[model samples]
Target: MVANFETVTSGVNLNQYAGRLEQLGPALDGIGAYAERQVKLAIAQGRKLSGERLAPLSPNTVAEKRRSRKARGILRRDGGLLASIQFQRTRANEVQVGSNLKYAPWVILGTRPYKIRPKRKPTLRFYTADGWRSATEINHPGLPERNIFEGAEKAIGPFATATIAAHLEGDL
Candidate 1:
């Protein structure tokens, strides 16, 4: 025989919190997928707008630099605005890193010169077989923010449905 445990009731429905947490997973997954697609689209868009002649560094090197200098120049011109959207909390994909989000608005400009200090000791240096590289790295940091945004948006529609379901279940 199973022992019946007496339950205490609270003003807030306990099921709601559990339901929210359960719903969070799918929301996150949808967000992740959206973010991945957006990054790829952005990369493609950037490459198209660059108008750079992509020539082989050598006949053997087939891995083309997707972004051209002209594209980078254009990106740099508007990078400040992009950075602002990236860092803004109100923006769909804005993310906050260490320090504060305030720095984001101007950080993308690349206008600030990086200061080089003399090394205290001789640094070990070696030349790799590969030559120079492009500025476009595959890392997309906006993904998490995108996921959160999507999750939040998804939650609104489901919240009402879930609440109604809970009420009906309790009635039975």
Candidate 2:
């Protein structure tokens, strides 16, 4: 008996998966388009609401005033409009949200196409000497009602703020 060994790397050759890859494009595109449309709508809604609220502050001012306005929460609190834009950008960059079966070809068949599923419960797990341990688990207080993207989008607004604050505070 002879034992043969060869180095095996983990990856799907896009060329090898071309057929499946082609099947995935339309679905990936659809998800992407849906996300893009939702993000655009979210930003537009934010802008419209903010614009309506700040309608009284019309009339362009000098650069200094503009800077002051930003500081004073005139244009958008902590660049909220820009924050909203960045929120979309963040989601766009998020592996869980932005990723699709196209890049993760195996997920399509092995999993359910990687669509974001609403999380009813989110638990943090840790390794212990005895076994796996779960820390305080907070069930999605808004679960069984909202889809994952909606939940993510809603949560991201505050999470992003907290994240920035944490970074600035050197907590992260």
Candidate 3:
């Protein structure tokens, strides 16, 4: 079933492609860390991976930010969430980049109007534009979808692909 190579002037070594595929091992190993970095960079730049500017913080949130000196920068309160953004190797060739914070979902995916009430207490006390107030329940307007996790796919997708391609081609 094979053609005669004796008549051919140039040599054909199809095995080269198989060897190139070996480069994927290293590329896969580093992809997780690379993706985490891109996500953090996008946050610092205050932009989405698609080059769109991130939505501004809510007005009440902004006021809260101003009130607390510990809150520095957008979505950075005490730097906990930002520092929590990391890469975890779930499998030999698989990795996940995200935060373990409970509110990460709320940050990426906007919530609908909901009621917030005291769980351990008889009532709730919070400050408002008018001043401090006491209530049994409060209606939260909810937040907008930041879609920060979208950074991983949009920013790292092509970069990782190109890196693996370059490595496979021996051009990395």
lDDT winner: 3
Clash counts per candidate, in order, are 0, 0, 0
lDDT of 2 by residue, 60-117 (tens): 3223345445543333334343233211122221312322214222211122322233
Cα-based lDDT at residue 61, candidate 3 = 67
RMSD of each: 16.0, 23.0, 10.0
List, residue by residue over 45-146, the lDDT tens digit for candidate 1. 432112322221222122222222222322223344233222112222222211133543232222343333335534322222364433322222221111
lDDT of 3 by residue, 39-157 (tens): 77776776666767777876666666666655645666777667778876554445677788888777767789899999999999876545568999999988777776654555667
| Pairs with backbone N, CA or C atoms under 3 Å apart (clashes), candidate 1 | none
Candidate 3: residue 7 lDDT (0-100): 13
